[model samples]
Target: MKKNRRRNKTKAKLTTYGEFLILLPLCHKEHQTELLEQLKSAKRPAFILGKEVPATLNTITYGQLDDFSRINQEKEDPAVKVFSILMGLSQEEVYKLNVFDVFGVINFVRSELDRINKLFASIKVAHSPEEIAAGVENLNFGTFGVIDWYAKRMGITNQDDVYSVAWIRIYTCMKNDNEKAEYEQRLNKQYVEKAKRKR
Candidate 1:
């Protein structure tokens, strides 16, 4: 039993560490090595003030990412946003972190942002002006667009457990249905295409 628990902790830690490694160069080529060394030296993927951090961020939904992008326009609080939304922690949990951990998180996030900002800075987004704007009357707002789908699919209910459903489970259901449909409406379009080509 003890061996199993130890193995699980190591697995979770590696998974979490890998997540950071995958998201990096979040800054410059120089900082990439620096960040890698930092994560390597740190006891990551678990215990910010002895509170176990989740191994994976599968709980986060696409909808939450959309909200994060919109609300964090200035990119002022990457640590808070990541800790809360990605980690699935509450605002109060942010208070539990020490100043050192918080600083490390901020550095990691800012490095990524710096890399992104530099890449996109010179690229001009061209917008063609619209001649005619569609009216609200033209838009059809369904009474149960989302509800009608999930009701038949996930057996989703108005309950606490319903909210706790992982996004991957929902996405898997959709992509599996897509596979059954001969890739007519792929939720994971790129993956489906690439995997098909391999066959």
Candidate 2:
């Protein structure tokens, strides 16, 4: 019984470490090698991002890569537009992110989702509302990381202020889907009116 428990614990640790390694993104070329070396020297469970799995020439997970074989799609413009509110760094900050810094993470997540199976790809990766919900849940986890990163990078000084704005925008978006859609449609209508006047 004790031996079985030990084996199960080891298996659980390995799985978590494996999944964590799969999800990490290395920022630099040398970071990968450095990570592997550090993991080896410490003789501890660790994951490397942006780096090949140690002792294996095969890069990329076969299962995750094969997920891209299915059809890819896009989401509603309004959904994406409103989603971007939570997705992007606020313009009010003193340390504005560079274009690359701002969009780089977004693009990387897109590409990563592209590699996943069709059933589990991304926001657009989902065709049904239920599927979209699941994908959005996964996407939200990623977005939350970005918001936290921004807070750290900007020296937010007040966690409540940052979190409050995030919750407000998220609540507004989710509170009334129909109303939000109508609001966006109204904005588009006004834009069209302005364009017609210009013509």
Candidate 3:
């Protein structure tokens, strides 16, 4: 029983170390060689398994390369519009993101979407109209729009700030979908009035 437990612990540690090695290449290229050397020096105990361990790290290396290629390919994909909408970034800014930074932003947006979806799901499951109303009131919608409006009013036009402002406005409207149509109509009217004044 003790031997079995020891073997299991060793297997878990090896699996963790293997996963770390697999992800090391995703780091900046300048650090890749040093990381690889460190990985090589981290020795794992060889225990008998049904299959022979591969002699080379070629498979893991290829997987990292494939991920890099996929990220580059995705830059041209129409689905990137979703990221732009979520993050309030322009397509041009999104295209400029480093692959790792893009991955991080994508993950952040995905998690936020999941949280928002769950909130709506809870609102749907409420038993009474009052409960639903309470849920809706508690929902943190429109805060991003307020922030964006304030930022733009203050004339903060730097690229990052501009994107953030846009993102907040879009994200707020998306979360408040029932009001978005009316909100857009109001925005169009405002734009038209501004254009008329300019004429």
Q: Give the TM-score of candidate 3.
A: 0.26
Per-residue lDDT of candidate 2, residues 1-199 (tens digit): 7786577435433433324244336335564454444333332112222222222112333222222222244632221222133233222220232222223333443444444323232222223477577775555554345346445655876544444343333323334544565678689979999999999
| Candidate 1: residue pairs that collide | 26-111, 26-112, 27-111
Give per-residue CA lDDT, model 1, range 33-146, as digits (tens): 654454444433345645665444355553453334455647545556766655555555654554335545545444544553354333322222341243433343332333
Which lDDT value does model 3 have at 96? 49
Give the alpha carbon lDDT tens digit for every residue of 125-165 in model 3: 22346756678546544434434544565576542443333
Model 2 steric clash total: 3
Error of 3 at 69 (Å): 26
- Runs of candidate 3 exceeding 4 Å displacement: 1-79, 125-199
Evaluate all candidate structures by whole-model CA lDDT and list the values in order: 0.48, 0.38, 0.44
> What's the CA error at residue 181 for candidate 1, in Å?
0.8
TM-score of 2: 0.18
How well does candidate 3 score on lDDT at residue 5? 52
